[model samples]
Target: MALSKVFVSLMLLISLISTVSSTGVIGGKALPPKKPPVAVAPAYAPIYSPAPSPIAVPPTPAASPPVYAPVRRLIAVQGVVYGKPCSDWGHDTLMHASPLPGAEVRLVCHGKPKENPLKIMATTDKNGYFFILATKKVSEYGAQKRCRVFLQSAPTNSKFIHSTHMNGGLSGAYLRYTKPAKPLLFALYTVGPFAYEPLPSVCHQKV
Candidate 1:
């Protein structure tokens, strides 16, 4: 009986060892092999973002006015007058002529046909010079082309007589040497040194 009891104890101990080695359990709980520490991923920063842009616009233009200039006007006419001797006729008589102080001269401008011509008159001063301020009529004539200076009359009491020598006593003298006159608002046109002649009888007497 002692031998049988010992044999039963030995059998139970061997059975326990076989169960522990096959299942790897100590107290009925499983001990699985420790899986390599689960490889963990690292943390990272968030991606960057930018804001939006604005739209563009165009500009407007300005308006302006036109400008004009003023026109030049005609103002005055001037000249000198002289008296020639009978012998000085039909010859260059400038040096032989003398100033006719109180002589009368006329400005004649022929306008459109059938219309009365524009006429202006002036007298010689002490130095035989004459300056005629333009009238509204003369300015309207626009230019000096159609105009002329003629000897109208000489001092009646003087020995000088109206003669058609050198276009001074009868014919017309043209305008020349344009210049500026006083008051800065007008133009001055110069004419010739018109002349008159002494009587033929007077010339013979002097001879």
Candidate 2:
């Protein structure tokens, strides 16, 4: 009839807008609101690269303490430390041999370090000749009217007489025993010798 009612009213308005655009109500397009599901931020559980810190311990070095030395004896007195034109006591030389043959000769036994302490007994061999034998505490070594002996050319092989004297002699050694003491024959100390003038006098009488 009128073009079949304008083609059946545009075919019922395009079949009610394609049946409300597939049920999304109205002329479709509200489907865009579903974009809320695009929040895909839940897959970050694989970043396990963290674990390194522990190593530091090194410091240790401390332990040392102990040393006390002093014990020497063997006394036999009958000496000689000549130099300075020395000869006579059996008359043997015009200074025979020792201008300084590794010097050092001391027999300090008269109230040593303190009361009675000087017993380096003996030392001097290598053409210098020294024979010590004084260490028995000499009856506890306590009766010093005198027993002073010294020839400290610093013995112990005085480096070939300090390489050739300069002040080597330093001279000294003396004795004056008198308490039933008499076995000291020819005590000759040239470089140096003393008793009241050498050095000795502390004090002792114990037993």
Candidate 3:
């Protein structure tokens, strides 16, 4: 009797297990088989187009600086030359000294009553005027100022440095004087002892 009971119990347990599985009780439903994961294609990097280079804007040019010229000292001289009347000088009575074309003239400054005066020379215009005539023509000069001057005719070799015992009736000083030579010289000279040395010295050098 016990052997039969044991067999019967075994069969009953097997039947219960099968029924539980098929009925889906206690989470016994058959599970779908898991497929292997699909192979993933590697994502390609986006094609590299070099990033557009930024357009460079050029900077504006700097403004140019202003330029200036040096100031020139301007002097004015006016006078009559005696025989220096140019070819155009019409009459003997016309302001004969107005201007003499082609006459070369000079002006001078003396370091003192003794030393040779500093000389500045110029040729006359058609009007017989010299801008560089003499420094005393400037408003800022005086009589008894130690100076001597002479004029030379170019292309003619005619020089007319003048000789004077009394100029402008002043006693000691020599002044701007005129000698009447168209191509001849208009110059200044002294009767004093100092005159000889410089006259010949200058005459030899330039005249």
Best-fitting candidate, measured by TM-score?
A: 1
List per-prediction Cα lDDT, in the order shown.
0.75, 0.42, 0.42
Q: Select the stronger candidate by TM-score from 1 and 3.
A: 1
Q: TM-score of predicted model 1?
A: 0.60
Residue-wise C-alpha lDDT for candidate 2, range 46-75, written one tens digit per residue: 878678776776767666666666433223
Question: Residue by residue across 59-128, what tens digits does model 1's lDDT show?
Answer: 6556666676666666577887788777786466677788888888888887788989888899999889
Q: What is the lDDT of candidate 1?
A: 0.75
Measured with C-alpha atoms, the lDDT of residue 128 in candidate 3 is: 47
- Model 1, position 90, has a per-residue lDDT of 49
Better of 1 and 2 by lDDT: 1
lDDT for each residue of candidate 3 in 1-207, tens digit (9 for 90 to 100)? 999999999999999888876764645565565599999999998898899999999998999888886432223333323332232122223332333355544455556557665566556555444454344333223422544434444313333232222222113334543333453222322211111011344445543
- The residue-level lDDT of candidate 1 at 79 comes to 82
Regions more than 4 Å wrong, model 3: 1-76, 82-99, 113-116, 133-144, 154-207
Candidate 3 TM-score versus the reference: 0.28
- For model 3, give the 10-residue run with minimal summed lDDT: 189-198
RMSD each, Å: 9.8, 16.4, 16.6
Global lDDT of model 2: 0.42
